[model samples]
Target: MAKSPFRWIGRLTKPVLIACVIGFFSAFGLADRIAGFSANLGEKDRMVRWSAVLSGATRDAIPVTLIDIDPSTMAALGHPQSAPREVLAGLLSLAAAKHASGIFLDMDTSRPGSPAGDAALAAVLAAYPPDAPPLALARRLGAADQAGNTINALAEQASVLDAAVRGKPNVIWAASVSRIDEDRVVRRWQLSHTTCAPGPGATLPSPQLFAAAVASAHPRPLSDLNAFADSRTQTACAPGTAAASPPAWPRNPDQRAAIAFLIPDGPDLAAPQFITRDGRRVPLFRRMPARALMSASGAVVSPQAVADDLLRDRFVIIGASHAESLDGHLTPIGFLPGALIVANAVATAPAVLSGQPVGPLGATLIALALLGALVAITSRLRPLAAALAVAVAVLAALMALGRIFAPSTASDIVLAALGMVAFLSTIEGIHAIGKDWRARGWRALLKPEKPPAAQPTETIT
Candidate 1:
């Protein structure tokens, strides 16, 4: 016997419908929105934390060290509102002498300080060896303009510090700004902050991002970074154009990258400590007080031998950790100081740049395939059994994803798959309900009246 066309259509309907639904959702970014909601609910954070715990801790020494200006260091510096430039000069010189691979000064240098202090800092920067490790000084972001676009020249320290590092090959300005999500949690880092420059058709890299690039193992030249940032924008103003108005920047979504936090923060903002596979507990990043690098007279206190032992071949970050510094940020692990955040960025820069091993398209395709298989298997089971099977499948998929990809990427894919599951389940439920209703209606129509209830007529007779 020949098969009916309806039989073939019925056989292909569910799978084709499933594929269309998944394709529509992926194309429109509804899946991404669902994943983002999962992140907002802290599911991504939990996955990251759990993944870190499961991955055997690194026994290799951490490559970064933090020179924190804690409460004690603040008190020693006479409780100044900001770390004094003169004091910072001493720390810079000490790190240089120790031959640190990179030095990131996380303090504000926007406004001019005491003439002597400014001179001292400028002198240190000028005297820094051209062949020595790069020094990145943090420049604070100024208030955005009325139009909400960041003005490049408005960086806090640009006016004063720009001249300090102008002729110096080793010193550069970097932005210390971090992107805060709607929930106010710091989860992502930008490679460069694209801002409009005062000159015609000029674009500048935000200092913090520049600093991060400098701090990486393979640093890019400033010109390259600027060019890269410029390429993302659509238009550049003509030279000699008035700075009053500039071209609108392009809405490039790739400006920011996810930060992979390797070290978790400790309680009360204490130095983070973690246990390694060897069963030994140790600090994640070696931390020393800023005062330890300076003498009571504010001279370089750490001898070259000690400095080399601690800072040599390591990225050194100088920033405040005191409560008054107001530099703390809420991270996936816990509250961490801004300096620590930068350190994490530097340490994990390579991974962040590489991004997920699987792209969105690949992940979606894989997820849809798995979903199809899951539905085919579950369709043969009772409703209760089907639910159990789905739950198990989800758990297994999450575990596999965690092992195969970074926490953020894994969370996104898994959450997206769950959305598809929910959507399919709802559709199937409605179909079943409709089928039952139709069956009941057909039976009612076919059912015959039982001789008009003959008993009532018999009673009358």
Candidate 2:
């Protein structure tokens, strides 16, 4: 073959050899576009964030609030046997009387009336009216039967309950999204708050939303409390003789309620300690102990603080804090105390309630700039050394950013981390590919392939 003079040049230059790898990622839409890079990087960063956030066994700042019971408690309580309905009622009543700013009920009534096991739970829930603002079912029980009868029955109960709690206090429901990225970590909390019915009536709403509606429903300005009346409609979520099932309650000016917040709760959590009595301490996630007291008993927070905040017209979300009940969250520093999250809920309610938004792009650009400098400096170093430097830098950046982002409750951390990861991975992948390509070319040119005729010549000899 003609002397492949350019072959040696390709081997030494390295750029030509790495072009295939570069082109491969680019063609796959991974390394080529900013959006793609941002997304992939964002996802990986989310994983790392979760790891770092949940690394220690410490509790999360967000409380692992338990509003419902699980199988273990059920077994302990001697089920098939139920916790006295009165106990359930008393606890809720206590919370409301204590000026507990808000309450969220996390439970499912999906199979109500379907079987003996489900019917008892349904009755206890139906006893509370939706208008009372003391409770909100996290969700209607999903369809358990082929005919969807179970779902229909639960929907009716929810509707009936919704009517009773129309505008009392902030009694919100909870919802969650099931989707996740390449990693199982839930990056987004898709308001798991929605419902459909196959029965005469169906209804559903988040406890937070209900509670906000109640708070937001207080029509008067902060100063003119005496003149304030609920401007919110009193329309019940129950069926109104519509040919098809009527829509759920708080439906006005659109289906949206007055309250909505984008804060997320981790699904990667342990079950909560659903408190039925006043004195029992609720357990937190990971079987951690958290005291759960009837809000009325004033066992949890200082009365002075509670009174002051109540007077200031702040909302309070009082739920049991137990590890077994998982009333805690995994925060960056460690497990944050649940009490702090409750305080944040009230302290920043105005911003969250008002729907303040922070831009991800701004965060991304800033992070990228910082990372770019770091990458540039590290790029010249050996791979291991560079990796270590980048890792340290990332940790420092995360701690600083955690402080900045916490107050605003923004998604900036994920976006920023993603930006950093993307740039670094791209550069590293490219360099490795280039080196590999260069090595291959060097081997090809330095030790040319034996002439094909040599094989035939050996046979002839």
Candidate 3:
């Protein structure tokens, strides 16, 4: 009897269908979490260039600036963890004089230092004119969530500077924290202090917000700070909508804002030019050594020049950027200083407002479509051939998409394709097993052993 044409397909159907269902569910469930991790996998160098290229690498400088308390400054000052409070005060004083839009110190002033230094810094902080840019000092916040906490209680949760500096009205305290992923990479920026329970007359602002507060400072009040605090939008802004308004603050204190990193245009980061891994040119904000803020004689550098080059109307972030600071992190663009991380977060505000980061919906749909095509193709082609073809096509597609979309979304698509591959491969293995079993049975049934045995016995008799 001839075998039914549908027999082979029937054998493959159950396993294939079962695998597809599992694949779909798993892809939807874990793709966003696990697959999105270790983005470059071990290809940090290449991925860095790729990430920069996709971020629309540019040659123009951004408005932000980095005043790093880097190695050079450290060598001059003879301290590791702290820069002279007097020096910091001098920097701030100069920034104020230059008409800076915002000045943020990514330093921990939680403890009191030299009294004179502290007093000088405090004096500078208090002396800023109403028209001058705001100065925000970074403070570390405790991990305990304050979701239902009281006013006084929430205040206690903040690990702020000593009473002297923390008491100033001109200085805003922005929490400096990064939502680190399992891979130890910072992919999200927490915008609210929701975790620190809500209380009356108490608000928690992120360091990013403090920096922005300075950038957005004008003679006129924008609105009650609290009103805008919890209303940040995570979705991309609509077309032609002005990003002019201060960035939306998330209502959920734990909400994480997506970070769209700027690409590097050069290898020697300290140099003026930035370069992507692919040799493409990109622009970055002006970065002056923290040493530049002061002269070799420990005097403040050209206040006017500093103002024109870095401070005037530009958002300034001061932090430790050199390697010894140990603040470097693994980014899509390889290891970078924490200063750049803050800069990236600040820069992301405009990008998000401009709707540059594509959402996951479109990428998810594309992933699903590709998965379905893989399933259909595997059903018809030789199993091995199908696997190879699908893998090649999917990887290529993902690479192309990674160039256009964010890494997070690209990961989702790749993850979905991987799930489909697992499903299809399993079904093929089962079909092959059944095919071999049937082949063996047919060979046995068609064997001529019995006739041969009978003839041998008769001849012997």
Clashes (candidate 2): 53
Candidate with the greatest lDDT versus the true structure = 1
Q: Residue 358 of candidate 3: its Cα lDDT?
A: 45
Better of 1 and 2 by lDDT: 1
Cα lDDT for residue 432, candidate 3: 63
What would the per-residue lDDT of candidate 2 be over residues 69-149, giving only the tens digit for each residue?
343433444443333333344445444555443455433333333343344334444455444434444444433453355
Output the lDDT of residue 193, model 2.
29
Q: What would the TM-scores of all predictions be?
A: 0.66, 0.44, 0.61
Clashes of 1: 6
Candidate 2 vs candidate 3: which has greater TM-score?
3
Stretches > 4 Å off in candidate 2: 1-72, 81-87, 97-101, 110-135, 141-160, 166-187, 191-356, 406-461
How much lDDT does candidate 3 score? 0.58
Task: Please name the candidate that would achieve the greatest TM-score relative to the true structure.
Answer: 1
Tens-digit per-residue lDDT, 1-461, candidate 1:
45586888897999999999988999999989988876765476665555433322122323677888888988888888777888888888877778776788888776788888889988888777888777777767675563244553343325466776887766766665677999999987765543454333333444334534554445556555545555533243333444333212211223455555775554445456542312445344677888877777756575543636577766788888888878899988778888878877665443333333676688798778777868787878997899789767756765666455543455556667667877998997666666666657644434344683334334554
What does candidate 3's lDDT look like per residue over 52-113, in tens digits?
33443221223577777777888877755667778877777777777766777877665677
Model 3 clash count equals 13
